[model samples]
Target: MTRQELRHKLQQVRRNLPAEQQLAAAFQVADKLEQRLESFVPQETTVAVYKSFAGELPTSPIIERLWQLGFKTVLPVLHPFAKGHLLFLSYTSKTPMTINKYGIEEPELNAQNVMPLSEVQVLLMPLVGFDHQGNRLGMGGGYYDRTLAQWHNGNRPNLSPIGLSYNEQQVESIPVESWDIPLPEIITPAKHWRF
Candidate 1:
């Protein structure tokens, strides 16, 4: 199937999940991630994550767990000046949030609150679909593809890009474009996938 068709199919599959199942999956993913956190990042390292939207896997539980575990967390904000790019901002329980053009909630932009890419150790990203080969199909905006292009090109050796999704989002194969970046790892309620 085509990329757009696959995205629609997987997105609907996830969106159809019961609320209780979504909650269980969120907590399950959080627990699995906590068990493997130390292997990727050191103590107190900054971990960048996205706020779940649409039928995406719920990340609130994971975010709360990270806060309780003392890991510094950051969230992606649409870059104000750079079109199609994302800026990571310091996210906490108290960070003021605003809706972006896409209607997704993000931490309010503040220059001082921006976390440089050099300071980000792990980036937990959301996706519409992912495959066993680690290829990720995003919401078609290419925000993450543009943001992590450098990392995929071996420029950001210190950065770890991980995708978060539900098991149902997995596809047999994804039609990849030249600029698509495959994630090194992805975590789901069922299993942790390492590519």
Candidate 2:
């Protein structure tokens, strides 16, 4: 099937999922991802993560676990004045948060931008779907693609990009653009596939 066709089918699957089932599936996927992530001893101290939103794979539990394990966690902050640009915000339980234009919860702008993507040890990326080759299909905003491209051009950080998704979202292939970033690893409810 074509990329558009697969995207449509994935959307239909998403729409068919009831709220309870979605949450249940997300929890299962999260469990599997956390287990795999536990084995890696990160070279970079700080990690980047996204705050979960509608129909996306949830990461809050995993973030909390990482925090408990003494890892510094940062959440992505979308520039309030710009489109497709991102800033990293150090996150803690007390850090203030607000909804962005996309309606996703994010850290407050007041949070200091400590370091760039190069400083990040790991990035737990959220995706709508993924294929075995680690190609991620995002929500079409391309914020992640742009940010990753920038990082790749600069003193590229030793960061590992990992995609989280449910097994149902896996496909044989996904459309890739010139600027699209490929994930090195993808973790689903059933297993982890590394490229």
Q: Which candidate number maximizes TM-score?
A: 1
lDDT of 1 by residue, 1-195 (tens): 899998888889999999999999999999988887867444558999889899788999999998888889999999999999999999999999999999899999999999988889888998899888999999999999987897977778998888888888888889999999999999998999999
Query: What TM-score, computed on C-alpha atoms, does each candidate reach?
Result: 0.96, 0.84
The residue ranges of model 1 lying beyond 4 angstroms of the native Cα positions read 40-43
Candidate 2: 10-residue stretch with minimal lDDT: 35-44
Q: What is the per-residue lDDT of model 2 for residues 28-127, given as tens digits with 9 covering 90 to 100?
A: 7666756766756643377788887766666776777677667788889887667778888888899888888889998888735545677787778888
Query: Which pairs of residues have clashing backbones in candidate 2?
Result: none
Q: List the global CA lDDT of all models.
A: 0.90, 0.76
What count of clashes does model 2 give? 0
Q: In lDDT terms, which candidate is top?
A: 1
RMSD (Å) per prediction: 1.2, 2.7
Decoy 1 TM-score against native: 0.96
Q: Lowest-scoring 10 consecutive residues by lDDT in candidate 1?
A: 35-44
